[model samples]
Target chain A: MSDTLDAALRLMRAQAALVRRFDARLGGLHGVSLADFTLLLRLAQAPGGRMRRVDLAEALGLTASGVTRALAPLERIGLVSREPDARDARVAYASLTGTGRERLPEMLATAEETADELFAAPAWGERDVPVLAGLLTRLGGTGLRS
Target chain B: MSDTLDAALRLMRAQAALVRRFDARLGGLHGVSLADFTLLLRLAQAPGGRMRRVDLAEALGLTASGVTRALAPLERIGLVSREPDARDARVAYASLTGTGRERLPEMLATAEETADELFAAPAWGERDVPVLAGLLTRLGGTGLRS
Candidate 1:
């Protein structure tokens, strides 16, 4: 905890807050919560339009139970269709239906605009963007390098 | 969506995963959970080891309710003390406790390593961190900018 450390915290705090805002605005614009929007997009883009529950859970950084809970809204909207896996009855396959595929493009577009806006905080100059990203990347190294 | 839009989604997905990983690893390395850990550090570095709940909420990008909930654990652990604002009874003040002040340095050291490790994603080289920070700051500009 020196002055440099204090300065780093400000940058890290900004980095974390920006990511959360990206989700909020993106979700608000799309009329779909960020978490739900991601689920829809993931299912729509997956091969065969389906993914195993466990794999989907991993992709989402959620526990299996968290995914089940999150799926309720998607299922209610008919955007998601979950079924017993053909190869493994114990596994459930979650896929995007026609409605989800149709809605995804619109949501995706709004989301990107939100992302672009979030990426450009005025307080920090344009040059600050990539510099902070690089510094954060270095600070967060997994200890495999110098 | 066009190819470029899809690329944005790809970036969102990758960054979201990295943030979650960063949070998880930070919590694991130290006994402090991510939310509590961030709270303590912010409080310690604030003007007087205290700040308005709304300001903290804004800084943390958490909704009011989310901030309230996050404060509960900290308060319970005696790391944070909550008091009704004399100027505005409806508002609450969250101040770091003496214990919290003493513990801040150690917690931050843990964060330094975690932040460094996670920011070191191969995708963001040393030179790219500040640029990403700037972009993320801009990204927070539109909407609630929460």
Candidate 2:
């Protein structure tokens, strides 16, 4: 039981390290951090490639203030734009801009490569990739605004 | 494929968030971050709760300087001690103190609870846990170093 528990810890750690490395490398290549990449990815999920700032924070499990700190750099870089919502003047909407849309393809490609490398681990068949991915996603608890 | 890819990324992000939460909570309880807890765990693996600093770095997938930085706080707390290796003046050794030994069980119990809470992902089982753990340990690229 203890041994298995150790394995779960290791699995989590290995995955975290890989993400950090990929984030640092790919992020450095394009002058963004992993946190920046994540924000962009979140924006990409919206209908017009954007989300409300508070929504993005909840999605990422980050405090609204931390989201603001991360967004400042992205906004400064022109990757994100915050404007008063047309329907709700008090709410600010964070939307991707021309710069963010343009840079995403490159980031996505780099992400794929990193995933490819990690998937090369033994017994990790190509098919098993989706299986594990499914388990993780359901476990991730995304879109739980309720 | 895109859906699955998103899932993989989500799994990775969720795992990172969970660990960070655990580290924060555990740090409050033990005055040690997860990284510090790991160093203590590694020290306990040595013949008599002692190992060379370089080896510790290698075992933890950390650069020597990173290990040095982590050691500073532990040494200050007297939970661990560092000394020049008796046989090799150039080598530094890290050893656990009586306080450290006494504290290990408490930390381990906290760790077990944290793991149980964080990695309670679907489809996980005791049988699959070791296989994943051993695979992740190897994935860390430290197999040859240890």
Best by TM-score: 2
Best by DockQ: 2
Please write out the lDDT profile of model 1 over residues A52-143, one tens digit for every residue: 88778877666789899898888887888888866778998898988878888888777767655554345545555444444444344232
Model 1's i-RMS, to one decimal, reads: 6.6
Candidate 2 ranges beyond 4 A from true positions: A86-90, A121-123, A143-146, B1-4, B117-128, B134-138, B143-146
Task: List candidate 1 stretches off by more than 4 Å.
Answer: A1-30, A116-146, B1-30, B84-91, B120-126, B141-146
TM-score of each: 0.73, 0.84
lDDT of 2 by residue, B1-146 (tens): 25434644766665656567668767978878878887898898789999888889878877788889999989999999987776778988899999999997788788777777655546565555554454455445552231
lDDT of 1 by residue, B55-136 (tens): 8887766677888999998889888999778888888889999888887677777767665655545654554545454444
DockQ for model 1?
Answer: 0.25
lDDT of each: 0.65, 0.72
